[model samples]
Target: MLTVAHSVPKTPEHEETIHKAQYNVARAYFMGFGAPSSEDDGRRWLDRAAADGTRRGSVKAQTMLAMLFARRDTLDLEKSFHWHSEATGNGSLESQGALGVMYLYGLGVRRDLVAARLCLTQAARRGNIYATGQLALFYYRFRFYQHAVRFGTHLARFEAADVAELARQSECLPGYVRRGLATGCYVLSRCQLLGQGGLAADGERGRLLGGRAAELDAATADRLQRLFVNGPWSCASYPDLGVEV
Candidate 1:
């Protein structure tokens, strides 16, 4: 399946088709979808896909490369930044969100709330639901100039209503995000846990939301499993999130 794509060179004759084929083959291999998984082949094909220079969906290849290099075990932050910067410059909301997260955690670049805000804003404005959730979680309008102060200020100004607004907006999200449904449900579930938006603190609601998210997307389910520590929905103990986003 993987070699089938490269058998026919990607030329001007069938550039779009070839690019799509290569990307599909690479994604299939990467995900082991009816094919033997091989990261090396997947990465090679993704590189070819990005090199195709198709502005339309090349961001997907670039984002994949960025995440591949940014794996915690690999820790090649420079390459991660390089790919993410490419995707971000190409107007990829997912890449923008990822770059914002990198800046926020100082993964590759220095920690800078300004940079984070810029990237997050770019993604959120384009209707990246996860980016919207991040924006609601971390507000950066104030001129705090320090991490602790900025963080404290955001917490102080945080309101439960904001969660409801964010959730309402993310209900019908764009298709650009592969896990938009799962992410939205997860964010809303967190809000439920916190008793935000005039809602009661309900662990069952949180679990139900998590389960629904997992049903919609397996990746989201895996993320929920990590957060729950037991299953997709159940939690041994809920954390204390008192008025803090």
Candidate 2:
């Protein structure tokens, strides 16, 4: 398979075809499918593929390259930004979501809430689970009520594909605790608390989510206190809410 795939690069063909072949071999090498596992070789091939990916911007190659640079274990913000920016421009939902996240937190580029919000909205519409969750948090933080109405339900996706996405990206569960998605969950729960979105205002659900977040990290507990206790979310307004701040 490697031999057959490698031969395509030497044949006279379009750059896209050649790059696609190269990316496959690189993936094989990186994952030890048809060749000895070699990060260096895989990276080399990915670089070549990403360079040639320019015409149409190969989403697979560039997205993988971006992940190589941005994953927690190997965070190379500059290269991540470069590849993500390229693929994002080419309309890769994965890249757009990733680049949007970077923009949201100034990971590689300066924090541009405008660009981040635009990219995230696009990604969320495209069904990027992480993007939906992120937008829920973003909208809630900015008090974008109408906007929150669109994406706030993402928290409820914990049992569905969003969990799978988090697992694949290694960014849900434990990772989200660090990245503040857990907190995002709490905020969405708050939305549930106040029926901010189209939700029917269920404090039981709110406590369920907030309780989950509080169980995960102490910092979130502090935040919960501030928001539920000291903030405008008065339990007195509705005495039925069983949980105290």
Q: Estimate candidate 1's alpha-carbon lDDT, on a 0 to 1 scale.
A: 0.58
Alpha carbon lDDT of residue 114, candidate 2? 94
Query: Measured by TM-score, how close is model 2 to the native structure?
Result: 0.68
Model 1 C-alpha lDDT per residue in residues 1-245, reported as the tens digit of each score: 44645666555646545666778888988898877999887888898877633464456677777777766565587778778888778766677777876676566678787898888777767656556544544431232223322222232232323434544453322332324445555555655666654457899976776566566556644754465455322112211111001
Lowest-lDDT window of 10 residues in candidate 2?
A: 236-245
Candidate 2: stretches off by over 4 Å: 8-14, 154-158, 161-186, 194-201, 209-245
Pick by lDDT: which candidate is best? 2
RMSD of each: 9.9, 8.8
**In candidate 1, which residue ranges exceed 4 Å CA deviation?**
1-4, 7-13, 52-57, 140-245
lDDT of 2 by residue, 95-180 (tens): 77777777776666788889988987887676565566667767776788556655545545453234445545632233432324
Instruction: Give the lDDT of residue 10 in candidate 2.
Output: 42
Among these predictions, the greatest TM-score belongs to: 2
TM for every model, in the order presented, reads: 0.56, 0.68
Error of 2 at 49 (Å): 1.9
